[model samples]
Target: MTIRDVATRAGVSPATVSRVFSQPETVAPGTRQRVLTAAEELRYAPNPVARSLARRRTGNLGIVVPDIANSFSAMIIKAAQQEARHAEYALFVTASEELVDDEERQARALAPQVDGLLLTSPQASDACLRELADIVPVVVTNRLLDSVPAVLTESAQATGHAVEHLHALGHREVAYLAGPDGYSNQSRTSGLQAACARLGLEPVVLGPFPARFSSGVRAADLVLAAGVTAVVAFNDDIAAGLLTRFADRGVRVPEQISVVGHDDTALAEMVTPRLTTVHIPAAAAGATATQLLIRYVRGDDSGVRRYELPSELIVRGSTGPVTARST
Candidate 1:
C-alpha cells in the first residue's frame, strides 16, 4: 500500500499525510490519528524515493558497509539505527562484500533515496567517493575522504597500540591476521608494520583473511609455524577462531602463544581464554556520523567536519609474556 492509499482511507489529503510526518502539529490530532491508523492497517510503507523527490528530503540515512557479518559493522548499524529513530529518521543498510563495483553500485542506488550516506571504509576510489559526495552528503566511518566529512574510530592507531602491548609482553616476533583488501585493512597492516619497525621486530602479515571463524582455523597453522609468541587478529571472530584452533592443537593460550584481536566485541570476553583486543568505539562513531549527516541535511554546512573518536586496548587472558618453549 502507498501513502496515497492511506490518505484516501483516512479521508485526508496526501499533503495532510505528509504533514503528519514532517509537521504533525500542523494537522489536527484526530486527523493524524486516523491517518496513522489507516497506514498501520494498510501496512503502507512509504515510497522513500517519491517522498525525496517531492520534499527534497528522504528522511532516511543510507549506510554502506563492506561486510555486515563483522561485529564492528553490526555495532555501528545498531547505534546508527537508534540515533536515526530518535531524530525521526529511518536507517537503510547495505553491504558491498568487499567489492569495489558492488560498493559503487550500492552507493549510487541508495544515494538518491536517502538524505545522506554513511560508508564504513568503502572500497571505492577517491574519485568515486568525491562523485558520491557531489550527489549527496556522505559520511565515511573508519575511512579517510578528502571531499566529505568522516567519523573515524582510529583503527590503524589502535592496531599499533595492540602491537605495542604484545611487544611489551616480551614478544619479539608478532603476526597479523588481517581482513580483506580494503582501505581499512591497509591501515591496519601499516599500523602493525610501523610498530614492528620501531621495535626492530619482524612483522608477519598474513591473509586478506575472511574475517571469519573458518578463516581463523585455516590461519592457525601459519600462526603457529611463524614462531611468533603473540598474534594479533583482524577482529574478534578471528581471535575466537585462533583460540579454538589452538586448543584443538593442544597449544595452550598465553602460556604457549599470546593472541590479540581488534574490535572488543561481546564475543571477546565470552570465550574461556578471553581475547585481548583493540576496542573500536563503533557505537559512538555511528551515532556521531548520523547526527552529522542529519545536520548536513538540515542545511548546516558546519556538518562537514571530521570527528575522530578514541580507541583503546582491552587486555584479556589471551595475551601474556613469551613462553620459554612451544607447547
Candidate 2:
C-alpha cells in the first residue's frame, strides 16, 4: 500500500515511518519494529525512483567491462552484483565489447543514470576516464590513473612469478604471446620484461594479438617458429587454444616445449594438459571496486588512490624442464 497506510496501522506518524525506512538509526527500536511490521502486513513498498529523486541519489550503481563474455569479466560481474545487492543498491551493467570508443560511450550514457561507476579493465585512456570521473564518482579496476581510485590485480608481479617458475624449470629462452594494448596488458608485459631481465633469460615477444582462442591457435605456429623452450600466453583461453593447436601439429607440451598462461581461469584446468598460470583474483577485485565506489558515493573522501590485490603462480602440467631439442 503506502507509507501513510503503514503509519496509520502502526499508530505512528508518516515522518516516523519514513525515518524508519530511510534513517532507521535515528528511529527508536520499538517504533522501528512497529513501522516495519505494519509495512510488512500492508505489503507496502517505497518507490525507489521517487526516493532517489527527492534525495538526489539514484540508489543505483553502474559497472562497465570490456568483454562481459570473457570468464574474467563474468567473475567480476557476478561478485560485483552480489556486493551491490548486499548494499541495497541496484546495479546497471554494460559491456563495451573491448572497444575503447564503446567504453567511452557507455560511461557517458551511464553517468546520468547511476550514482557512481565501476570500470573493470577499461580500455579507455587516462584522459577519458578522468573526464568521466568529473561527471560521476568512479572507481576503476585493472588500470591505474593519477586521480582515479583503482583496484588493481598484481598482474605484473604475478608475471614475474611465472617467469621465475619457468626459469627454475630450466627454460632459458621463452616466448610471450602478448595481448592487445591496455593497462592490464602493459602491466603484464612489464612484469615479463623485468622478470626476464632479472633471470638473465631472453624473451621472444609475439603479437599484440587478440586475446582470443583463435589468436592462440595462430600463436601456436609462431611459438614453434620462434623455437623457444617455453611460452607464456596472455590468458588461459589462449593457452588452451595453443594446447589444441600444438596437439594438431604433433608438438607435445612439457615434453618438447612448456607453456604458461595468465588469469588462471577455469579453462586452465579443462584442457588436456592443465595450464600453468598466474592467478588473478577476479572476484575479489570486483568486490573491492564496488565497495570503493559505494564509499565514494557516500562522500567518504579518503585519500586512497589504489588498492592492489595479490596474485600467485600455479604450476600445472603444461610447464616442465627444458628438453635437449628445446635447448
Candidate 3:
C-alpha cells in the first residue's frame, strides 16, 4: 500500500521507484517493468498530490468549455476524459458559462494546476488566448488560430454540401439562425455564404443569436418574416428550438420550411421530426486534442500545429422539397 514497501519488494531504492512513477521514460525498460509489477503486486499507488508536489507535474489536464450543459460540450468532455485516462492522466473540467471575462479568469486559474490545458470552443479572443498559452501547454478544439495549436472539425466543405442539398430541394431563399459572434460563428457563416454564392441561392442572414434554445425560439418569427423557404441553424440547440417553435405555430417542416443544423447532437434525433444536420466528429476532436496536449507536455512534438476532423451532412426528417406554401 506504500511506495516504500513496493520499492523494498522490488529490490530497488525508493528514489528509483519514485522516478519510475513520475518519469518512467528516464528509467530503464526492464527496471520500469519491475517497479510496476511490484507496485501492482503490493496494490501500491503513488499519491497524486504528493507526487505532483515533488515533481512539479500534476499528471492532470485541465479543460474549459463555454456551456457545460450543452450536449456537444458533454460529448467532447467525455471523450477527453477517456483519452486522458488512457495516458495515465486525469482530467479537471470547468465551464465558463459563455462569458468572456469568466472564461479568461477560469482558464488562467486552471493553467497552473495542471500539466496542460485543453480549450473547447473558447469564447476569448485570440490575443488573450495566446497569452494563456505562453503560460502553459494548450490544445484548443472547435476553433482555429495560427498562434495557438488547435484541433477542429472542418465544416466548410460539408456545410457547402448542405447548402447544395437545400438548393436541390427547390429552396431558393434560406435564412441562417446564427450563433453569438466567435470563431465558430465566423467559420460556419463564411462557409454557408460561399456555398450560397456558388449555387446562386439568395442567403438571408437572420441573427447573431446566442447558442441557446431560447434564442432559436425567439428567432422563429424572424425566420418566418424573412419568408425564406429553408433555414440553417448554427447548431442543434438552436435547431431544436426552431423545431419547437415551428410545431407550436403549426408550421409544417419541409413543407413550409426546411431546417438544417450543424453538430449532429443527440437533440438532432430527440426532437419531433428529427433534424437534418452536418455530423461533426466531436469525440474524435476531443481525443485528438487530449492526445496532442499530453504529448506536448511530455516534450514530444508530433509536429501537428493544427488538426481538422471530417464532417458529413446527415439527411434526416426535418428537410424536404419546398411546398407551394413556401412559395
Candidate 4:
C-alpha cells in the first residue's frame, strides 16, 4: 500500500524502494527486481501527484492536432499515444479545429501541465511556435520551424512523382485542388509547380480550399472548367468528394479525367475506383516525434533537430491515360 510496506516486504530501506521506483537504473538489478516483486505483491503503487510534485515533472506529454476527426491526424495521434505509453508517459491530446489561434492557445494552456508538447501539422506562425517552444520543450511534425525539432514527410518528392506519372500518361495539363494555407500546403504547391515545369506540363492552380469532402464537391465544377485532363487533390478526403461529383455528373474517371490525391488515407480505397495517391507516413511521423520529444524532455542534447520521412506515389484504379476530347 505504501513505499514503507514495500520496503519492509523486500527487506530494504524506504530510500532503496524510492530509488527503485524513481530511478531504477541507479539501483542494483537484483535489488530492483526484489523491490518490484514485493511492491506487486503488496499492491503498492507510487502516487503520481506526489512524485510529480517532488520531481517537478508531470509524467505527461501534450499533443495538439488541427483536427481530431481527420484520418491523417487520427493515425498520428494513435501512434504517438502508443509510443508515449511505451515510454511510461501519459498523453493529453487537444484539437485546434484547424485554426492557428486555437493551436497557440492550446499550446499555452498545455505547457504548464505537461513535460513537453507534440504539435502535428500546426498552423501557428513560426514566431508563435518559437515562443511556445521557449515555454516548453516542443516537437513538431509536418512543419519546419527554425530551432524546433521536427519530423517532416517528403511532400515535394511525392507530388513530383505524381506529376511525372500523369505526364507519362499524356496529361498535358493538370488542375491542383489546393488545401488550407500552411507549410504542408505550401510544400505541395511548390512540388506541383516544380513538377509541372520539369515535365513541360501546364499547371492550373485552383482554390485555397478547405481540406474537406464538401470542398472537393464544390471543386468539381472548377476542375471541369479548367479543362485539365488530370486533377491532383490536396488529400484523400477531397479526392473522394471529387470522385463522387464526377460520378454524379457521369464523367468517367481515367477515361475523361484522371485524378490523384495525397495522404493515401482510407477514403482513397473506399471510393469506387481506388485513388492513386502519395503515401505519407503518418504513424511513423507520430512515433518519431514522440521519441524526439521524450529525448528532449530528458535533456538529451545531441543537436538532432529534424527527422524527414519519405513519401511515395501509389498508382491505383483512379488514374489512367488521358483521352482525346471532342471540341
Query: How would you encode candidate 3's per-residue C-alpha lDDT over 227-295 as one tens digit per residue?
Result: 898999999999988989999999999788999998999889999799999998988989899989988
lDDT, residue 282, model 1? 83
Model 1 C-alpha lDDT per residue in residues 88-136, reported as the tens digit of each score: 8889999987788999999999998888889887778889899888989
- Model 3 stretches astray by more than 4 angstroms: 1-45
Please give the lDDT score at residue 283 for candidate 1. Answer: 89
lDDT of 2: 0.89
Give the worst 10-residue stretch by lDDT in candidate 1.
46-55
For model 1, the stretches where C-alpha displacement exceeds 4 angstroms are: 1-53
Error of 1 at 179 (Å): 1.9
Sort the predicted structures by TM-score, highest score first.
3, 4, 2, 1
lDDT of 4 by residue, 1-327 (tens): 889999999999999999887777899999999999999999888998877766789999999998888778888999999999999999999999878789899999999999999999888888988888898899999887878999998799889999999999888879999998877898899999999998787799998887888888999989998888999999988898899999999998978999999998887889979999999889999999999999999999696789889989999999998767511
- In the range 205-262, model 2's lDDT, one tens digit per residue, is 9988877788899899989998788999988878888999999999998899999988
Model 4: residue 109 alpha-carbon error in angstroms: 1.4
- Give the Å shift of residue 257 in candidate 4: 0.6
Lowest-sum lDDT 10-residue window in model 2: 47-56
Q: lDDT scores for all predictions?
A: 0.85, 0.89, 0.89, 0.90
